[model samples]
Target: MTKRIAAGAPPGLHRALSIVEETAEGSKLWCAAAAVMACTGGRRGRAAAAAGLASVATAQLISNGVCKQLVKRRRPPKEWIPHDEVEDRPDSSSFPSGHTAAALAFTVAITPTWPLAGALCALPAAVVAVERVQSGAHYPSDVTAGAAIGLTGAWLTRHAPRLILRHWL
Candidate 1:
């Protein structure tokens, strides 16, 4: 299934997606989002930045520490990928895409605080999710799992503080 998807991607998009896929590595994309939010600096901007940062961090930890460790899935076959993409691909477990997790988490978390920004942010998030599969780094299932984790993480980040305070009180 993954091989078919990889074989079908446009040659032009492969390079761009690989470049954008870098956002997944070290959570640089999320950092960029936060930086953009920081520059906007006001009540809404701060809230958006804080939520995006928190979502990305927590989703990354859960995906890398818990989900990947538990699944231990291998990446898609290198042969199925274009020559340029092999080196850029990840070596970690493949059941859940860390890149997609961070991308979606950032987008989902930002939506409530800044709906327009979040809507704009989703363009790249959607790209990275598909790119994870198209680049031969992850399967569709992996991207799906990562997205689920990201969405759940975003929800948790938004609501956890209230829940925590409620329990304490």
Candidate 2:
């Protein structure tokens, strides 16, 4: 699947995906979006931004810190990717894609508070998932696992406060 995507994607798409992946490094894209939402979007936007940021942080810690530490899978082979970006992939374990996790975490966290914004975020999140495979950074299963981790992070972020309150009250 990685080989087919790497080989089949056109140069234009490859360039676009590379740019998206680069922009997403360190969660810059999502942070910028959060800032925008906080500044321009009213109360709902602020809530969504907070949730999204929290989810991203949670997902990052789990996927990059814990899960990656436990799993020692290697990235897809360079030969499988036909692009220059393959050389830039990190040497970390590839059992889960941290980038995909962060992206999905942000998108899912914001959905309930701001469905339209969540819909907008979905496109890039999906792109990041595909780019992980296309750039030889992860296998499809890695991205899938990352996505699951992301959803879990979002769920925790969204419900933890309520659950804590319910327990206390």
- Alpha-carbon local distance difference test for all models: 0.87, 0.93
Query: What digit string (tens of lDDT, one per residue) describes model 1 on residues 56-164?
Result: 9889998998999899888887898755676666677998988889999999999998998899889999999988888888999999999999998899999999999
Off by over 4 Å in 2: none
Query: On residues 1-169, what C-alpha lDDT tens digit does candidate 2 reach at each position?
Result: 8799778889889889989998999999999989998888899899999999999999999999999999999898898888788888898899899999999999999999999999999999999999889888899999999999999999999999999999998
- By TM-score, who's the top model here? 2
What is the C-alpha local distance difference test score of candidate 2? 0.93
Query: How well does candidate 2 score on lDDT at residue 46?
Result: 97
- Model 1 stretches with alpha carbons more than 4 Å out: none
